[model samples]
Target: MQIRVSIFLKEKIQNPNGHFVLQTSGPVPYGFEVPGLIRYFNAKGQEVRRTRFPSGGNYTSALRQGSFDLSGDRVTILGTNMYNTPSSQEMDPSTTSNSTRKQKQADTTPNPLATEELNLLAKLMGGMEVQKILNVDAGFKVNLLALEQEEEGM
Candidate 1:
């Protein structure tokens, strides 16, 4: 079964191990299981990574403790919602309770990368030439634009 979920990174905490702790938020469809598996995709819809929340627990809190090595900033997470109605009493109440509480807490935390920063990072990582153009002080904007036009012409 296909389940549509809107996943957004709530906060990113830098860990001592150089990996990041990503706190994400999204609505799990009614009857969806908690601590479910989430597969992250890039903008191209390519599956980049996958993670599972600890069993028998709320994912919002568990996600805070999970570590990930994400190279890009934008991601789309996909997961299946097994049921249309809640059958497990434990899953219903805890999911709602934890989501509500975490929502508030996540809002107060700052996002690791702003939109513009993310865009720049994506561009810099596009290719070695893009990185070189961004680093050079001489007409970098014009050079980047020209490179884009060249790519489109190909």
Candidate 2:
């Protein structure tokens, strides 16, 4: 029987091992296997690491101890049978023609200034510092009428 499993990154706990707890919950079939494997993937769809659930009598038992030391800003998790095949499997370069490789190569070039990095830099520098660094001219002009009125009032 096929069972649906959902894995969520609950929170990162400070411990000696820098443990991160992942909560898994879903419908379980009778006599389902316990201590399944959980695979982690990066944004590039590459398998970075895999961890086994805690050994216990049932799937839920193992899932309760789903703590890992993995650290990443973004991650994708997959359980067994969740998909027909794992998404991280590398493509056979021989199967692809040269044109496909060329297109991929063109897209693979990393941008030096990503929007997120720029935003972070701006935040670090603050608005006034950024304006100064950019040489933004906050042009100040004196109003003749206002000056004349101020002198007359004085």
Candidate 3:
């Protein structure tokens, strides 16, 4: 299944009614964060999560959106509109230093996601609604089977 998610950052004044929302057939807005009030709608345009993650990440499970009041006259969201944590499997190349070695190891032993890991991911998504607010345009698809090797004799 796939979810179509669109994420944009705008000042509070830009979205006064807070009607810009994202929704998928499946539970998507789980594990997202919204500092202020937001109005997530269903296919029928009903309110879902009032708040959403302005900043996106992988590690922290939750992120806060940026806020700006029109009265201030000067409000800017700088340095990358979105934020996200690295996936658990993403290794730090700087520390490893040996890219070839890492590649070989990864190819030999493809770590399968444990049940607990899947549950945690589901919880994070459910809690933060990551998919609802995530930038689908930039998101990529992963094929778990591609990471595993097929047995010759079964």
Candidate 4:
């Protein structure tokens, strides 16, 4: 069955102005290679990003993390040991340094996940977590529930 996942940008974490929301459609199998996830900005045009599972890389340790970059717009998505960790933070443009720039280049390199981060992420992926589910209808109810169940199993 086909599925659609709503990737809501937190209110405080808006994408570059004029960019549309990222509503991913299709069955994203576990360890799926999310390629060229694009977001458009009025000022810069289009930006591209890669979203892939990082479970086998440095993230194999305690947590998993993934990375992505929206170069032209200066936006990056970094996560813990897991590719799509529960918590995310944006780099402040006001602060620039060698290490910071290096990290930006790395884009979505999985970062070491702390104990708390891992646990929180797990909970979020689990039913114990609460999220604002968007864009649901009778057709997708079953698929979404299955998706949630599948995610919790992970």
Candidate 5:
């Protein structure tokens, strides 16, 4: 079986309801800083696989999708979007280096989201077998298999 995941970044704004909300004004040109660990586990609650190395997942506009292969009746994928961590991974000076240090800067900018605060979404899937395909287009991006760059041909 095949699985796919897509991610995007949006800004949070208050809609005059005194509540903070995420809004997508239009197309975002920059890649999102999604550095962290991506793990795939089968129905038994054991790690079936994970990225060979931690990901420098700077989600780009490219195809906006990550694909993989798996076979199972059920699977639970845990995407640990590591942000504000104590140590930094091999990252490009452009993608996320500055995004984290700044506060939610402005409503016009799409800031990193700490899910515990609210909504959650990042395509994840796990099963007996996994092979990541990080087909990219213009900027930095990765899939479940992304270690450094992406396999555009995959």
Candidate 6:
């Protein structure tokens, strides 16, 4: 499944206006190169983004927090962070960073999971906790172009 959010500029736009066109760092589509996983068009009526995620490919992506802003004739998709495969974590920069010596020092606030009870308590902290108290989808937020579409009555 693919979702798109686009903003139409009052004036014609150049490709430079496009944000996050494609990436190898975030979630990539099944059997597709990251460079082509997403396509961006800055033309007026062509919509801004086209992301592909073919179904039945055992492909699933985790969504990160996002927001949107809609104006008279424009929409802005704040950003998106979709998940790649679980086994592919080694290829993710963010994941790699977490293991960095520097990151480990900052979060050195030892995961309070040392004690069995705190370990259980950690399950309750969710997003605020580096490790979840529970995987309650606490930090997940999806922002779509619903407002812009609503104006179109669809």
Identify the leading candidate in terms of lDDT. Answer: 1
- What TM-scores do the predictions have? 0.20, 0.20, 0.14, 0.18, 0.15, 0.15
Model 6 agreement with the true structure over 78-146: per-residue lDDT tens digits:
222222222354334345442453543464474443554553454455422233347553332222344
Off by over 4 Å in 5: 1-12, 23-38, 41-154
Writing each residue's lDDT as its tens digit, candidate 2 over 1-154 gives 3332332122222223444444455324334454577889999999999998665433342223322323211112332223333234223322445565465457656565564465556556543222223555332222334355786786
Q: lDDT tens digits, residues 1-154, model 4?
A: 3233334344323354535544344323335444433344555665554344433222211112222344322322223223244233334332434575566557765455553465566566653443334843211111235466686786
Candidate lDDT values, in order: 0.43, 0.42, 0.37, 0.40, 0.35, 0.38
Look at candidate 4 and tell me the lDDT of residue 14.
35
- Model 3, TM vs. native: 0.14
RMSD of each: 17.7, 20.1, 21.7, 19.7, 25.1, 19.4
Candidate 2: give the clashing pairs: none
Lowest lDDT block of 10, candidate 1: 71-80
Q: What lDDT tens digits, residue by residue, belong to model 5 across residues 1-154?
A: 3222222212223334344444333223334434355779999999998775554343334224322322111111223233322233322222333354343233235334443122212333312122334742222222456443455555
Q: How well does model 6 score by local distance difference test?
A: 0.38
Candidate 5 — which pairs collide?
Answer: none
Off-target runs (Cα >4 Å) in candidate 1 are 1-12, 22-33, 36-56, 60-141, 145-152
Pick the winner on TM-score between candidates 1 and 3.
1
- What residue pairs are clashing in model 6? 122-133, 123-133, 123-134, 124-133
RMSD of 3: 21.7
In model 6, the runs with Cα more than 4 Å from the true position are 1-31, 34-105, 118-154
